[model samples]
Target: MSRVLAFPAGRRAKWLVLVAWLIILGAAAPFAGKLFGAVENDRLGYLPKSAESTAVLEQQEAFPQGRVNPAIIVYQRDGGLTAADRARAADDQRWMAGKYMPKTPPPPPTVSKDGKALIYQIALVAPPDKQEGNYVLDAVDAMRKHIGDPGGGLEVKVSGPAGRDSDQFLIFRDMQYQLVLIPVIVVAILLLVIYRSAVLFLVPLFTVAVANQLGSAFVYGLIKNTDLVINSMSTGVLSILIYGAGTDYALLLISRYREELARHEDRHEAMAEALRRSSGAVLASGGTVALGLLCLFAADLNATRALAPIGVLAVGSAMLAMLTLLPALLVVFGRWLFWPRAPHVGDSKRAHGFWTRMGETVQARPRRVWALTSLGLAVGVLGLLAFNVPQQTQFTTTPDSERGQTLISAHFPAGNGNPATIVANAAQADQVKTAATGSGVVGAVAEVGRAAGKVQYAATLNAEPVTAAERSAVHRLREDVHAVNGAEAKVGGPAAIQLDQRDTNVRDSWITIPLVLVVIFIVLLLLLRAVTLSVLLIATVALSFGAALGVSTLVFEYGFGWSGQDSQLPQLAFVFLVALGVDYNIFLMSRVREESRRHGTREGVIKGLVTTGGVITSAGVVLAATFAVLVALPVVSFAEQGFVIGLGVLIDTFIVRSLLVPALVHDIGDRVWWPSGLARGTRQRAERGRELAPDKSR
Candidate 1:
């Protein structure tokens, strides 16, 4: 393992590694640019596989009209629409019908009860051969263009499935570039600040950029050739993960190499020693994260399940680049890369610094420090009670679809535009329709189409979409139709999809959280070679996750004025926080164990804290800042994830790793390393005595 690690830093091998990476980058660059084009943003991609809505979606393809993407053009005049307004609306409707639905015309415009608004429902049938995202984008773009400016005081906007889907597609399309650019910029700035050298930060940044490209290309291949399902959300997260994790690994390796440079004259020897010392932690950290992400395969939601492979590939690419490319680059550049503050052989290492003082403070009041910190974190967990799944579209900025939905809600039924869909046997269609209408929750039911003895019906709900009432209404409707003999009925649509997503999120959280915890515990045990410390570290990270979520909940509701969060937030947040948060603990505890073999446990704790503190904290900040870039996106879910994950990393960096974990280990002493020889305290005592007897020859 040492030979392999050092191979990249060899006098001749360094260039070989660089050349190999350049070749790989060249091959990956073209595929990387095509990754976004392969993203599956269809409605079914976000729904649960076992969901009734998913079944409906599959069955709809057989219908004569196929699956319809409804686009509702809403025109409202506060003082009541004039004859001219009505005429123009009719003309626009005719034009849309002629262009989109040539054979079948959409229903006539419906006036609101208050006579202030009008809505024209246009059914834009999706072509079976075309991609859903692109089709929706083109159709909505044409509709919006045809309508142009309203001219009068009348408001004109597109809403419903087609309009909303187009908006979502637009956000994702725009995000493809922003996700890559913003994270790169964030990592670059943080790296510069942390390194404080003009040239030093570039090596890691370039290495991580290569990792990003490789990850993108790899994911693109999986998505294009395999059964893997990926969405815009998954792609966005993959970009962030590659840069964040890759840069973190780079920081750790480089920091260790710098330390070794002060002791070794040969740059190659310095890098070799650095790699041998730090590679284990880097590999273990990457493994823990990759394994944790693998648990996502247990998720029923397509989007969540897709993240498993995507995340693992990202981590693997990052780990490969950092261990190989970064090491070679550092050796090739030698000590001059650090420039102004470069370390030299025989130079005295700084023994007292900010982290050293922090270690002393922790050592002074171990119990008090941990107790107060634990209390503070526990308080933050109270915010979890406020967590609520968002009932409306998750967007940071309002779009045309949202505006149209608001108008429709004010003037028509709250669920006016987006209606629930039901599929049933044609033999029992009449009975199913009657049952559905009599369910009381459904306002009306109409036959949409029929094919292969299966009939499709559109059921307009009396309740708004994505609410408790809407869920209950869909449930009742399904039950009512299922009671009809030989109907084989199922309920679906926007409301049903949201309900299924919520339920799937809950189930996934239960399964993946425990699985991830187990994976992390096993990794920590193997890495630290101690049982007690592993459990303690997992506990601290778990606490950090809860506190981060709790604080995020409070901020979302009170600070951002958001009513609720994305359904997937809790599960995604937990996986990332536990897996990534434990990384710092691993770095600290591993170093502490090595030092404990030479010094006593208490002294080892201080030494480890002082040694690894800056690099780990810098790593945490870089990771946090990369995630923080998500807040700049237009999607609310991405923003919430960014804020919570970023906050959790900060808490882990500053409080848990720095104060809580160190203080607890200090208070417990050698016993913290139970089941290991270090726990016996005999070796620790001998080492302490040997240290005290040092310099006797002088």
Candidate 2:
């Protein structure tokens, strides 16, 4: 990866070419794609065809589809409906309809019983088809802005796929500002605060910026060649990868530079030694995270599979930067980078009474501490029982929150809001039609037509559309149609779609979670050589994930008033909760196992917690905070995802890693390493490894 871009001698001269090349290439490729309109394809294109996709496409072809784009035009009669208000509303609707505008015929208006709420459903040229209509999002912005004002009796809240895109565009823009700007500002402040030197403080920022540029270019190249579903969230992932991991590497390099300077050695030797010593840890840490992300491939969902490689590329780039560019820059700047307060080479440890006391308490009463922590996590995990899978196609749309949707809900039967369709085929046209209009169902038989080999019917139900009741109706409709004599029927609609998605998600979860756990468990066991330790670590991750999901359910369902989280959220949460959460667990446990070699189990847990706890805690806090920024964005799905992950990190770091693990380690004593053949071997090896590096301390 490092060899993809050559190393240069003079910093300013080298960076100038790098910057120019990136700008030109990044601008050109996407513009070319848009002009040519070539569909982006991926390696997954090679996968075998699925029966589900074939069924879905066959169903889609049966409809002489009405306008697919769903539009919401909300009218707020903030002032009571008067003559003037009514006139203005009528006029606006006429103006929208009269011109040969891009918009399609608006659906009939559904008014509130009290007359304050009014919504007109507008249709778009087409629904969101990936290839042809992505540009519709751009066209829909004009409608939303028109609704933002109070010109007509209706205060329009135009939403659909187009509205979602507009919302996401704005949200991503804001996130880019915060994710990039805040980290830069925070890091700058911390650098100055810690180093008390303006020049040295800026050095890390400069190095990180260059690293980000190259990393982005690499990702852009991959995106061009592959059909990854890169979205706004990719921006945050890239920024964090560069800033968070880059800082850790910079800290290691700068620390070494200071140590060598204080030893009165030259800059080059100091940097070489720092690179040699720190590179192993840096490589191992980055490799662990990259491998953890790769586990997302086990997911049946396209989203996870898409994101996995992007994350790997970004992290891998950071690792390269840490090894090459950072070291080179450190060599160039020398000890003067730490001017003013200057970097120190003395004992790096700082005493903290609070952590020390906490550790001693756990060491004294391990059983009590373990019991309390376990009970707390169990209570939190109970929230998972109420976990609701969101019904909408897009995560941002919610039935309860939008007044336009609520108005639609009231006037239209639940199933009518989004109707499931059935396609029936039989030898006799009458039999197919009979199956299509079969009774004992929630939906009203709205339309029936006979085609060559199939009878198509669009059904709108009497219940709330896409609700549990509506899904039941859809299922019943399919069952009833299939039960008909000499005919076959297939069902598809929003409700049916939900059922399909739910089924897919459940299947994916089962497949991915166990696979990820087994892989991670095996890796940790091999790394540590203790079965008991592996079981404890995996269990901790599982508990942490459950607790996180439970809390997120409360936030999304009750606090934020969202319908529910995205269907894929649980699977995504499990991926992060297990993978990243266990990454920290491994870091903490490795330290603990090292300490356990020297002292007894009770003493070892405490020593490990005291030694590596701060670093792990800091990493967790940063990761959590970075993810928490998702909540501030109005996209409910991403918000739910971010909140779940952020909460997981917080709980894992402060509550589980800091408190629970230590208590369990202390309570178990030698039993913590039991049921594993390598317990004695691990101890012996740890002892020998410690002796080989006796002068160094964690």
Candidate 3:
């Protein structure tokens, strides 16, 4: 075992590894705190660079207003606006435009039909080098103070790109503060209960904290030097990944170390043997997730794909820490880390407790246990029939932005703040206007402005800009206007962007899911070294994924009552559920393969289940709790993602890896390891049931 060692060779070698880890942690501490500064909040920027939505954004840079943010002023008076109220609305618009946009005064307010509602659009140009979003927030705050709330039978709200962006920015910013503080508390409490020993509980926590810092520093460095982009969601998810997965690796390694302590007289050899024993499973688990996460790089949505680099880094670093830093720390601290319940020679079997009994029960009737579990999972899978993935953001309440959206939709063309614009040759301006008006979806069409020998016609839709109907109307308007003779009309706006994003997300999901499976299959083949076992593991995990998605869909629709999922949820859910779900299988099967070679097939399956079950379940619980932290975030999409992935992990841990896999392998006997040496002599496979005996003897 020492011949293939990477650190953890002896007592002195352990100290050296620990010292190196501390130095690395201390050096990375500064950069780790800077991770939040690298976050981006631009919803449009979430699209891939080459996407049509991204293209629309780029072309907007050529326009007179460029990409300036707009703060929409929506005012409504009951019983229709009086003469005084109409004049007040006009004065307020001119006042804000002059105060904020002195250089380029904004257009006049557009009053709604029935003269009850008015919209005043104000644009704010951000400072050239700023990406923090605080500039726009500062502007929004200034306006709110300047135009204090009115008390008459009139209502007013600040809404639109600037207002919504400002609110979202603050929400994510506040979330970043809570993201760091909350998950740590959750993990700490859970770890305390699971380990019982105060020092042992802190070991994984300390190790993962250091691991996250190192991973975060690397990410921050990447963003500083390259064109890499991250957002609040990035850091938020990274925190969960680092803590959840890192702690998982720690728990596995430590559990094995405790087991090895009873077999080896020297703590150093016990530590070394534990590292050698558990390192493969940890590496396999991490690699499964790392490879699956890497598939995100293939996604067309930048928000989804951006998780790849950080995820790979986080998980890869976790594997490294488990193999090196954690092992070294355990040896350095010695057996006292386990304290009052420290492992002594021959204590492994007696300490087995509940898992030993559960293993015997499972081994007794493998078919019944597995069949029942599979049936339960199938019930969860049936919920897939009710699943409807939404292609838009779902806000839980009538926030200022949504309230403004409602007013616009009710009293005027719903697309008042963000109207579809058709850019055509100036010669075809009349035909473009006529085609846009005749499209039926457009309530009003006018030549708003012209630039570089092109006419820009703005058409206000009769539907809310982000709704499916608005996107449909915009699509038809573009087709109709472009069909007019000699009119090369290019349509772009909020509706068009949403439609393009939805299309790109659907396309990306189809491409990435197959790629993810291929990646995971290759990883499993390498780890298991048997095609049959690898393929079966993949199939079981895929089924687990389907079942998890089915269950999550029902919860999101009925429990939370959310209408639609984010455009990228399907691909994200599949990648996370399949990838993370396979982690527990890797932990189980890797141990099973190791034990199968030593003991015969039946004994190996029983021993494998007993040994790995408890630690993996604890890991799963910690991870599920870690991800459920996202439900506390401001955005519903984060909550949705957290719910699905967390649910998937529990399914994998409790049902799939715990029962279905172990029992199936037992029922199949040596054929489970087909093409391997164990497959050659099936009759010699079953050994005496070691746990069922009264005494521990070799």
Candidate 4:
């Protein structure tokens, strides 16, 4: 059985593995560059197809004017806008009319009641063949360059819904550099500190660098050849996942290799033995995470579903590299890879380290140690009582569009740029108007765009588009519009879409959460082969998730000066935390089972914690640090998601895996493997095991 894993240990086999990987890397290179081209960032795409908002958005594709993204130009002066400011704003509209989107000229400009700001709204129409974001970005750049700066103490701000969105689009285009650079630098620093060996630190980095290229290229290929509609943001996330997860797998394998090398004289034999022992845990860890991520396919949200494939591709690719390329490199390089502190055939045995001391304490008073530790982590879980995920996710803090939105919202109707858009059959246009007016809509409903037999109406809201009042108004509009005898009317817009997304995501949580739990339970049960123990493992991970969420909310609220989370944050964070948090449980327990096969269950529990504690903690810290690098991203949602996952990994690492799990195993003793021989007082003969086992390896 070890022959498959030990294939890389052979002299010629290692060389062949390296050469094949090189070939794969070369072939996969071009597809990596084409990744971002296939992404569409439409907000409505995240909703279920049956949703009215989603239908309206999907139907828009058949219309010619669907290519347009609106832009708002706000000309503001401190006290009030003078004649020159108003004239300049007017000229700017005319300046853009023929030069920008000539055929579909933007309508006239409107001034605020206070007279300090002039609002000019324009529709930026993309060409028939062009991407909407790409075209909007070019037009925005031209609008910026064309303005230069409004003179005479007047400030011209390009803002509103489209402007804010376009600003983030530009950020996405430029974020690739920082995304790659930050993780590489951060991972390098952490690996150096953890390994404390120059060559060992660089090996996994080198291995992951190659793996990331190959993995990203393969995912890009999937986007290109398949019907998979991957979000552009997923690629950046995939990159970070590959490096972080790849290095983690490498660390575990190499640490075992070092231990085995100290026990055997032949480097090749030691590597083969290490591969046989470590591969099960490595494969199980990767599989648990991969399948847990796959459970996201049950989500109704497109973005959440998209993450499932991206995560699976990344994990599968990273796992293959660590199992194949990493082992080959280690085996071929021998102990030389360790450089300054290389493991030898003989090393000191029976030592006392932090984990050893911990194991000893757990053995003495298992119940007390775990109870106190559980109490401490449970206190952090109390913070979840106040955790609330908000609907609105901010893209930029200080974009001109954001400031312009505030000014326009304060003076005029807050939903100036964004309005409730209604789709109605032409015959019921009058009924549509009447229904909207009766539903407490403040503005008139007029047709803005045309389809074959249907028209679109733009109904301005009395409240801000993101406000609860506007959503309620939109909901009421939907009811009234549908009340029309034959209106065939559907209500949608910025507010409606958000309302629909919130509803859809809530539904998704209900579906995906239970499915994920079932999926994880099945995987763990198969690996551990014990029903009682698998259930216990799942329970602890679920508990950790609750505590992590509570702690994350407090940190985001107090530490980051943010009061709310993205609506999708809790669900997404749960998937990551449960899957990732359980990852440490899998790592620790896999070793304990191995030890139990040699010694009694109680003795094995201590041995497992003492042996695997350091590597698991190091792996956790590495993973946490890798995720924390996401703080470098300017997007608020990404930063929040990063912090939550990173912090959860640490909790799982230092608190859960290092303390909670070991103590539980110790206290439970043999029952952790119930219905099996080990749990029923069927103990391994330790005396014979000591005689056969090497002193250093034990």
- Top candidate (TM-score): 1
List per-prediction Cα lDDT, in the order shown. 0.88, 0.62, 0.78, 0.79
Instruction: Give one digit per residue, the lDDT tens place, for model 1 in 1-698.
Output: 78987789899999999999999999999999999988887887678768888999899889877777788899999999899999999999999999888888678899998989999888877677877878888899999988888775888999987888898888888778988999888888998898899999999999999999999999999988987678888999999999999999999999889888888899998898889889988988888899989999999898899999999999999999999999998898878899788999878775658998999899999999999999999999999998777545467788999889889989999777789999999999999999999999988888888999999999989987556788888889888998998889999887888788888898889999999999889987777778999899999999999999999999989898776888889899999989899977888887887778777788889989999999999999999999998898877878899999999999999999999999999999999998887899835565676777763211
Model 4, 1-698: lDDT tens digits are: 77988888877899999999889888877776666666666555456777888777666665666734567787888789888777877888898876766767677778888887778777766665866667777788788788887677888777765677677777777777677667888889988988888877777888888888887787877776765556657777788888778888988898888888888988888888889888888898888999999999888888788889889888888889998998888877778778788888778643648989989888999898889878887898899887766534365256666777777776677777676778888788888888888788656666787778787877877776555676677777888999988878987766778778777788888988898899999998888888878888888787777788888888877777664677777778788888888888888888888788777777888888888887888888888887887776767778887888888889889877877878888888888887666676636455566678764446
Candidate 2, position 96, lDDT? 51
TM-score computed on alpha carbons, candidate 3: 0.92
In terms of lDDT, the best-performing candidate is: 1
Residue pairs clashing, model 4: 159-401
Candidate 2 to truth, TM:
0.78
lDDT of 2 by residue, 1-698 (tens): 23322242234533554465457446644543332122222112212124232253355544454323334455556555565655665666655545313434544565666766555544444344643233444445555544356665444555433344345555565456676666666566655765578788687777676666666666666557776555556556666666766765566556545655554355555555555544655665666667767877765555456567866776776776666666666656666777765544453445756678889888888889878988898988888887777444344544222444454555444443454556666364466446556656644564444555766566666656445666676667777677776666666654565566666677777887787788788877777677898899889879988988997787667776677567778877787677777777776776576577666566777887876665566667666765666666667767787789889989998988888888887887777887654355445566676677763433
lDDT of 3 by residue, 417-476 (tens): 666756777888898888888889988886656667776666778776566677778778
Which residues of candidate 4, in runs, are more than 4 Å off?
A: 43-46, 61-64, 349-352, 682-697
- The pairs that clash in candidate 1 are none
lDDT minimum window of 10 residues, candidate 3? 689-698
Error of 3 at 677 (Å): 1.6
